[model samples]
Target chain A: MPPDMPTEPIRRRIALTDDGPILVHGPIEVVLTDGKTMISDRAVTALCTCLRSSRYPICDTSHRRRVRNVTARGSGSGMDRGGRGC
Target chain B: MLSSTSPRPVTAPALPAPRGPLSSAVLAALRGISAAPHAAEIPPGAVGQADPYGEDLQLALYCCYELHYRGFAGVSDDLEWDPGLLGLRRQLEQVFLAALGADVAGGTDVAAEIGALLVEPVDAAGVSHHLRHAGQLWQLREYVVQRSLYHLKEADPQAWVIPRLSGPAKVALVSVEHDEYGSGNPDRMHARLFADMMTELGLCAEYGAYLDAAQATALAEVNFMSLCGLHRRLRGGLIGQLVTAELTSSPASDRLVRAMRRLGCGPRAIEFYAEHIEADAVHEQLIRHGVIAPLLAAEPELARDVVFGIQASTLLADRFADLLLSRWAQGRTTLRNPLPELSHRR
Candidate 1:
């Protein structure tokens, strides 16, 4: 152990939004179902819950509601809509 | 610390050409060629008569605010605190503020306002939308030039609000700013990334390089940030502005990344927006939950100003978008000066 290292175990916090990503205090590494790992070193990382993100496991704000006012495909649409299982 | 061999040195940009009388006077004052107008010396209706959102006033206000940032090359650093210039700035701010106050439908329901910003209507005709659908390379280049004015100094205006906040809000905001500053890596700094994008697009990447070409609408969008950030009383408004930017940037950035790819721009040009797509997604969450929630809990009275900030910045942004879309529709350059041909150096 380093001379300045803390003696206690550190507890990590996770925040949940009403309609957004799961916020995790980070410098964290996540192992995907295929055994590949993704990491984020940001102070807080937003983990995608909606499964709509183009960058899977990371929030790309794809969870936000889209108001379908017109038939045209607008810029407000997320990067990858092919994730729709329908 | 930056070494002496740094590729880009911190050189101040040259003074931009003045657009009209007010800008001419402000520039002259900065150059020490003449005195800036003192509040008492100005004619009764002179300042009020200048179009609040027009070329003259916006450019004049922009020049005044520049003094607080990387001031013009030949302008004296001491002049940043010159009593005369400060007085002129105050007057300019009033005109701009009054216009914003008159234009935006002010409110205090921060949650409701943010909620509205979250939902994107499919009929949206914003610049991002146009670029995503039918934009040409020239239009994209023009858009970059106008946007370079702010992106070159990305996250700076909002830094002014740090000292004005406390507790969790301050910490949260700083965390977002830290990411913007590139998470302790100078090369990844958003400003540097924007400059890199400019270079890749065959545009001048120097700070304030496009000032002479940018339109009043572009200047107004940046000036609104400076206005709110500079005034401690408008701290809530500053947060509101910051939140609005974070909330909308992700999807817009995703569109921009696609636009760049569609235009066959290289990876460096696409990197800035591509990074924003994910970065702003994280920022949106931090701002809404970590920052706004705590700050508003402590200073609930600032809700009105926060809403004002959001609405005013949105209005300015819409005006900028309208200008670009209208100009591009007519096959016109949105900038004051047209951009040069893209250099084909791969």
Candidate 2:
């Protein structure tokens, strides 16, 4: 490592909201436990908390509703992820 | 900013041909040899008589606003602040504001408004819904062309309000603006991505290329942004417009990505909406809690303006969607002129 380069892991601010995605400031790539990596190049990115998102790691606004109707037909994915669209 | 540099020269688009008497008058002034037209007062109430949402007024107003964004080819850039053009623009804005103010039911309940926006309408009949279900490639192309009027210059109108804001509200708005500007990567800029999609779809990607084909409804959406963002009094209105866009963009963008994939479009075509789905999702949250909350907390009085912004934008969006859907229902083109037929190449 270069002498000027800090040998410490930089502490970053990640805001955890009461409900909805956990907000991380600046671009980040999350390596999930399942070994799938999700990279978001945005200045800020949202990680869905509800587990209903078809986009998985990143929030696709699936968590907006109070309770997404269980039997709703379209998830905007047009791809049925098993039982229900929502 | 993107590390790699491009060789091609970036230039402003040419002035569009006029649609009517009012637009013709604007075009004449812009194309003339003089930097600013000699101050000649027109007949009283001449502007008020023009339809608020008509093509003539919309296009005329668009030309004035365009001077601020990217001056038309061969037109004087100095005209952006020219008194004669500014005077004409003010008259146009008054007619538009009066009409919109009368049409929408105004309120200061920003929380309730944002809550309503969060819910996706089950029985929605919007253009995005139609596209997601069963819209043709040509129709989609035409839709993209009309939208390019604004998307080609995305984030620019809203940038005007930055100077008008301060404290946490200012910081929050700038945070979102930074993302919209591609978080320091110029190549990833939303406008560039939109242009990439246009090229992939075999449509002209040049800015203002489709201005002539854009109807009154399309121009009204962007005009509203310019109108609100330019006025310090309408800062709340600008935030309202931004809120509506960020809140609604994700779902609609998801549908658009599906539509593009369903039509077997190329990667570039699909990439634009795909990026929006993720980007706008973050933006939605930032706009609601970051920008709006802090703004209203500082100045509790701007609530009515905020409501007016949301309601006016929503009405305009519905009008735009209705126009496209109705035209497509009749098996007709939504544009004033049909798009140039796509050239086939491997």
Candidate 3:
């Protein structure tokens, strides 16, 4: 390491929620699997973890559970596959 | 050289016409025509007998709170602190607060309350849902007008609690507020965005332009924010209101964005809700983890008040939504003054 450079690496903290997004302290540049990059300059950014968000790479709160009544018959699968139908 | 047009002119809103005796008296006091009623002058039974959520009480309270934000065009600025007005405001607040306290099932389980807010009912009948699925452009326009009462001055009411909070909670809350204020960019401010959307929708974008048209239900919703915000003791409740707004806004905003697009609305009209889709998604996390956690840790006693704020605000929101939905169901205009028909702009 060069003498002019700091000896310690600066650490960035991110928070994980069980039912929601991963909150990363931003301005962060997120690169997707297809090699496309998106940047969020917000003070904090919520990266979608559920893959259900309409605004992919940013959570639009699509992770929230949709409650269907017991008698309601359809695809009983819990996750909404139609991308929130907004 | 840049042209020197002012970005936003500082025109105070016009005074709305009085709804009833209480609002008439309050307006008279604001106009400096008659002295505000002394405590004894108001019959003790008058405020008690008035429906807590009725036009008279809600309008009176709204006028009083308006003094703090931007005093009406002709109203004297000094009257904001007038003892008589304040006294009447206090009586009005007592009745309003008592009604809310009686209505809500009070508790201290902030986690449970938040958890419940997170679940979306599959068959939700909220205003946004109606707008997205089955609403017409006129109905959507009316929604904007009623909401303009709050959206035109967004993020202002909750700002009252900033001074009342300490440590990390305050820091987190301010960060969220900074975003609401457009992160130092005036044009991107949420209030500005809302005004732009209103203009795009062919509605008047001026602050308080629709006050006369807005009903008591709409005024009461904004009044509740001002009520909690102005009181230092109600800081926890204010936070509760803030969190509730942040938590629920994202998905609803998404729905509204889709509604606008489906109705052939332009980008300027959809921008406000479109921005909220991501902005509130981030804000929800900040408020829950960054603000609420440390706030409760520092003052656990506030949990009950926070819960009260959440439930009461939710109740008010539901009432507002119900009013709009039911009125729309009858194919009637929801505003006190029906909006003028929009010429074919789409």
Best by DockQ: 1
lDDT of 1: 0.83
- What value does the lDDT take at residue B48 in candidate 1? 87
| lDDT, candidate 3, B136-201, per-residue tens | 998899888988989888999989989999999999999999988877777778898899999998
lDDT of 2 by residue, B162-225 (tens): 9999998888888888877778888777888888899999898888899988999999999999
The native-contact fraction of candidate 2 is 0.18
Identify the superior model by TM-score, candidate 1 or candidate 2: 1
Q: Give one digit per residue, the lDDT tens place, for model 1 in B1-346.
A: 3523376788898998888777887888888888765767555676889999999889989999998999999888988888887898899899999998998878788887787778866667778878888888888888888888899999999999999999999999999999999887788888888888999988999999889999999899889899888999989889888887888888888888888888899999998998888888888888988899998899899889889888887777777877888888888778888676652112
* Candidate 2 chain B minimal-lDDT segment of 10 residues: B33-42
Give candidate 3's error at residue B285 in angstroms. Answer: 0.9
What are the runs in model 1 whose C-alpha is more than 4 Å off? Answer: A2-6, A70-86, B1-7, B40-44, B342-346
Candidate 1 is graded, for docking, as acceptable
TM-scores for every predicted model: 0.93, 0.90, 0.92
Which ranges of candidate 3 are over 4 A from the true structure?
A1-10, A69-86, B1-6, B341-346
Better of 1 and 3 by DockQ: 1
TM-score of chain A of 3: 0.68
Candidate 2 - CAPRI tier?
Answer: incorrect
Prediction 3 TM-score vs. true: 0.92
Q: For model 2, which pairs clash?
A: B1-B184
CA error at residue A12 for candidate 3, angstroms: 3.5
Q: What tier of docking accuracy does candidate 3 attain? A: acceptable
Off by over 4 Å in 2: A1-10, A66-86, B3-7, B33-40, B342-346
**Best by the TM-score measure:** 1
